[model samples]
Target: MQGTLNEIDIRSILQLIELGQRTGELFVEAHSGLTNTALAESNRSLLSSGGFGYPSPAPQPDERFWLVFAIDGRIVYAADRSNNNLLRLRDYLRFYQVESALDSTQVPLPSANPLEYACLWGLMENRILTPARARNIIKNTIEETLFDLFNLPQGTFNFEMGPALAPHLTSLEISPLTAKIVKQVQQWKQFYPLIQSPNQCPVVTDRDRLQQILPETTLANLESWADGKTSLRQFSRYFNRELLAVSGAIYPYIQQGWIQMSDGCDGMPTAASEADPFGIAPLLVPSEQEPHQRAPQVVCLDDDTTIGKTVEYMLVPKGYRASALCDPIEALSQLFREPPDLILCDLAMPNLDGYEICAMLRNSKTFRGTPIIILTGKEGFIDRVRARQVGATDYLTKPFGEEELLMLVEKYIGLPEIAPPPVLPSE
Candidate 1:
């Protein structure tokens, strides 16, 4: 069965599934253009009651799709479609200090199931995580996913009948879970303007004030966690706490102006870059006697191998180090590991397009200042305007020449400087 959320909300749909004891997957895709005006209208009563102060324009989620697997009307698993990258799984594994186990095992490529879900079973099989621990992780993951779903004001959903997800750890009843999440969602709304998203990274703005007010141990913990890189959601995973608890702990500091929250992008580079297994090592310069400075790094992402190679061929010979990636997912992983001096992104690609990628990068602090040039075949005015909206530094039409590519690069990072060779002494 399929319908728009406005006709039948998520709670009612789930209730129907439970009443019928149906087993299958429920796919939900959030409708784009859900403006703050709509949200304000829906929550007008709450606003009048003064339960929460909504931001004039709240931050919308980049994760627009979600999948929930069920068996006999019980939730088997749920995940955000955009977070299919192994990064979320890796973050969870880090809590157990067993993230290294992933390197030795071959993770199955994501197909019907997310890579993270598959890896969870892999971890169980390897004995890296006990069954009880795995079950708890699954529960927490489902809870977090449900929280987001509950907040979704409008979307399209379809429940398809089929066999359940394989190798399930545990199943949860929808009613109890829904009840718990509903209350948490209400509390979450209380910090509306102060804390927009769980994805918002909390940075300690007034360290001196915190030092004076907080105890030594409390201050140290705050310093360690509030490093301006990890988000409140990540903190929940790291501490194994509920999203509300993590946000609540930091909400006061946010209100006091002692902590400032910044928008966060999932899979963006964090403080733990060193632990990134897929990180691309910087190219080494050859002279030992006279150490040369590191060359400016440029990353070009395009599904067309030819386009990637063309960009690399054009840039590398100009004393710049260039890495071309055909796979958008791998490219994002590498980009997070080491943000290049500049990024050249193709506008059209399967799965993730350039606009979405650009928006994701702009959300993060790391790539906020980096130049992002959108490379596309389209030269329409609308395309350029859309690109600009997502924070593209410039737009370059396809079939661009070496000079055109270099000119844009030069405009942003300047021309790569090749040092003059040292003079040899005559014997």
Candidate 2:
């Protein structure tokens, strides 16, 4: 089943699938052109009032945004390639003041479907986020995903019927959930004049000006929230309020020149260098991982002996202890014997393919959250999705350069802080 979002609204699409009790996946990819124009048309005034106005004619979107629905016709799981869901999940966790829990918890690598794994680690596995809390988080996440999808002015969707996602800890009924979300989306549009994009981060303009006219309580809220680090999307999640509602509440301040919107979290700047070719930012933060004296371990697994050898060659000189295995069967045992901080496995291999190896490793408690990057010749969307399904954390296409490999490795395990081998002694 397939059609443009214009031909079939998301609500109708939901009802149609629900009525048929279809079991499969729904994929939505929205191109930038018309979608951006529609969004800008609705909220261009807000943009003009802020730090950066929307381009007169918004530039063409370089890359398409995507959303995936994992359903047994009941909507068991939903994910997006835009990082919107992931950001929402993070803000939702932080909204409940559970940021510290995630700080210590290690998330699996291929977070192409982060909402599912976050629930596993935060809700069921660690109990950091209780089942009940997890449910609310899931609800908010799904709501946000749907809200974004519904608003897309133009997009193509494809549904492939197959076996449904399994072991779902929770499921959302389509009928009522759709109704509630539809209402929320309507209300969200009402705030368009004030909030241009949820991605915009809010920053306080002047404390003195804010204090002069605003009540103490309201002023405090602005101070705590408008510290230039929280995006409007995050602000909404933090309060469990609709995006529009939160924007409306702060609209007065914005108009009074007491606050302004900027890009990134709480007005933090985003670096283009931080984003990968696919636009997915590495979930691992370098500062989050403490520096250590010993080099981090990295293991490369590929049936092609040269590929493994090349990985070792590239990593060894960079202060890493690297090893390579041509046999996937032996790779598992070797991984268990000395668990490397990161593993790179070839996707297509003889005697237990990379997917099987990844699935096997993920089954183990120790490696469940380990970084398992797939080295593949294929870069198609389906192949990447399959890699995620089998628990591969990330993928690098075959014939990748040394810099690509190093960047990925650094993203996961981080680069060692070597002190130049005490150069003073040689001098």
Candidate 3:
């Protein structure tokens, strides 16, 4: 129940836990400063138990991530020390378009157990997010976290056996969740050539061109949702479906060039549509006198000068103050001095890549709640899972368009509203 990742593979460890029907938490920590080769060597020890392939060019150390399992050894929840909110639950509710039932300002007290406890409590107390919906959220969250852990390459782990975790919303069998995630990860890899990343926003280039092939219902859904705005990832949330399903639905349109992926904010108000299906003027828009304010600091870390500059360019026009750093080493010091509202980091660098930087920040109390997004050319399955493991809030693929970058930033920290352009009457 206690050993370094070098000693036993995650799959084997999970099997043993399940076999023993263990209940409690498994704590994993990777020592910092281990080179890629050192990491691979350590992981080789893990695979020795059974010959499962380990991640090549292994992850760096400075570890901490946990999996809380039930007596049946089903993973009930997962998190790190820095996680201090029910934001994921909030996000799940919002994604399902049920956030309106709850108030954001009031959050329940912290719990030693899963925040799902607090989340389900709030939803039931207010009679809002719903028990069924809450159960789905918990199940999905735990499965997602387990999927990340299953792909983890190296770390020292300690298992603490104790009574089963309390206030369960739903229980998932480990075997099925594991099997499903494995299949999903493999399937995700297949879509890489056509869909580089889930963050790619699908926009209609020519409606007439698309209308020829797409069904009437499909075309309507595309027009209302695409708008050169929503990312494949966002679409997954809107439909309460998986990322692959959303991407698959639009794949054919992409090939025809009728729909192209663009970088842009979801300018059309989604909240209004979800809230007022009747289509009245937004119930939430501010009056003209309350001029949109500008100013949320954003920090970008990338070795490529162009990428850094491009991020700054995209954010500046949208009323944000952005700073870019090509050196990941220096970026840490800068963040320590002036914490930004959001951070965009690249995965590859000469020293201290995005993963390292993200983990360092996540461990710090100062940056716990701040959003850290990974910007990278690599869209591999393991890469995305690892990004989440280190506390990245989102992942944006390289060569991102202007709107794509802006929309992602807005998703985390909203932008100030600009005045509507003057309407010029036809002469």
Candidate 4:
């Protein structure tokens, strides 16, 4: 069956599948720029056809989509298309203290299923994880996927009869899982406006106040986890707790002005890095005999001085060498002379637009592989397609937060080695 979410919400769709005892794969795609009229027409068409039809056209590469595998009306597995990277899977494994096994094993070649799914089976085959442990992991993964899917505002869905995912660890009933997730979703909405997204990193703003109120152990735990880099979602995985539990614990502290939330990037290191049992040291430490290494260089090109300075202000504090250029023409000349590690070009400019700048950079072998991110206020699909065509590595919307800027830069060039904070003079 295929139809727009406007015609039938995800909850009703799942109910229908469960009642019918259907066994197949369901594909959901979230699209932008759908009008009310278009949605009405889709609903009418679906009603006339009795709510079952062929699948829609394939989704574009940039579109966000998800897949759920079911057997006998029970959920076998679900995954976000963009999260096919083993990062999410690695996070779960790390929680179980078996992530090292992944590093040692050769990941099987890609198949119809996600690489993470394949890796899970590989772990089971090698006895790295017992069947019970693998099943538990699968259950948690499905719950996390459902939590996000339940919150989707609109999308397209299709279900096609097919073989179940191979080597299935377990199949969970829909109603129970949906009911639990729905409650969590309701609670999550309570934190809205104050805590916008799970990607928002929690930073302790008033350590002195916290030390006075919280137990010494609790305060230390807060300091370790609230390092201004890790997000609430990562904390959930690190502690093996639900998202609501983690966020709820910090909600009051946030309201009390002891904590501040900032946008976070998925490129940050996983919780396992912070939980390393061996306490591994850095590869190299600077000494008087050796020259200090240079920080990652970043350049921002924008006609607005305020935006340019904002970029510089955000990055410089994080140990990056940042320069903001107001003149695109002169900026191009300087860039050619000494190419920065990453370039952030504004979309609208007087003489040179971001597209032209990106194309010009792509032509040169020096900047061909370098990361060029187009910053714009536009959210249309065509603009994104054009940016990709011009060899722009990524796109960021305007009026972005500091964490958003840092996240993109880190994703491309990686975080610089942070210098120790300067000590203050005694009173």
Best by TM-score: 4
Model 4 lDDT vs. the true structure? 0.73
TM-score of each: 0.55, 0.51, 0.48, 0.57
Compose the digit string of candidate 3's lDDT tens values, residues 1-427: 5666777966677778877768876655444344545544543343232212222334345443444456556676554322334444555666555665555424344444444455566676575754445555666666656655655677666576766666554555666567787887678777667666665777777889877866666667667767756566555544455666666667767787777887674422343233211122322112323312235688888889888777766777666777888877777998999999899989998869889999999898678668899998987999999999999989999889988888888777655344322332122
Q: Stretches of candidate 2 above 4 Å error?
A: 32-64, 68-72, 84-86, 103-123, 206-209, 217-221, 263-427
Which regions of candidate 1 are displaced past 4 Å? Answer: 32-63, 108-112, 264-427
- Counting clashing residue pairs in each candidate, in order, gives 0, 7, 4, 0
**Candidate 2 to truth, TM:** 0.51
- Report residue 225 deviation for candidate 4 (angstroms): 1.6
lDDT of candidate 3 at residue 427, scale 0 to 100: 20
Global Cα lDDT for candidate 1: 0.72
Which of the predicted structures, 1 or 3, would earn the higher lDDT when compared with the native? 1
Which candidate ranks first by lDDT, i.e. highest?
4
Winner of 2 and 4 under TM-score: 4
lDDT of 1 by residue, 160-268 (tens): 7776777675777788788988899999999999898888888788989888877776776676667667878776676555677677777777899999988754434
lDDT of 2 by residue, 167-220 (tens): 454566687788887787777677555566777777787889978876776666
- Return the candidate ranking by TM-score, descending: 4, 1, 2, 3
As a whole number from 0 to 100, the lDDT of residue 267 in candidate 1 is: 38
Residue lDDT tens for model 4, 151-184: 8888877776676676575677788778988999
Candidate 2: pairs in clash: 109-393, 110-393, 228-266, 228-267, 229-265, 229-266, 230-266
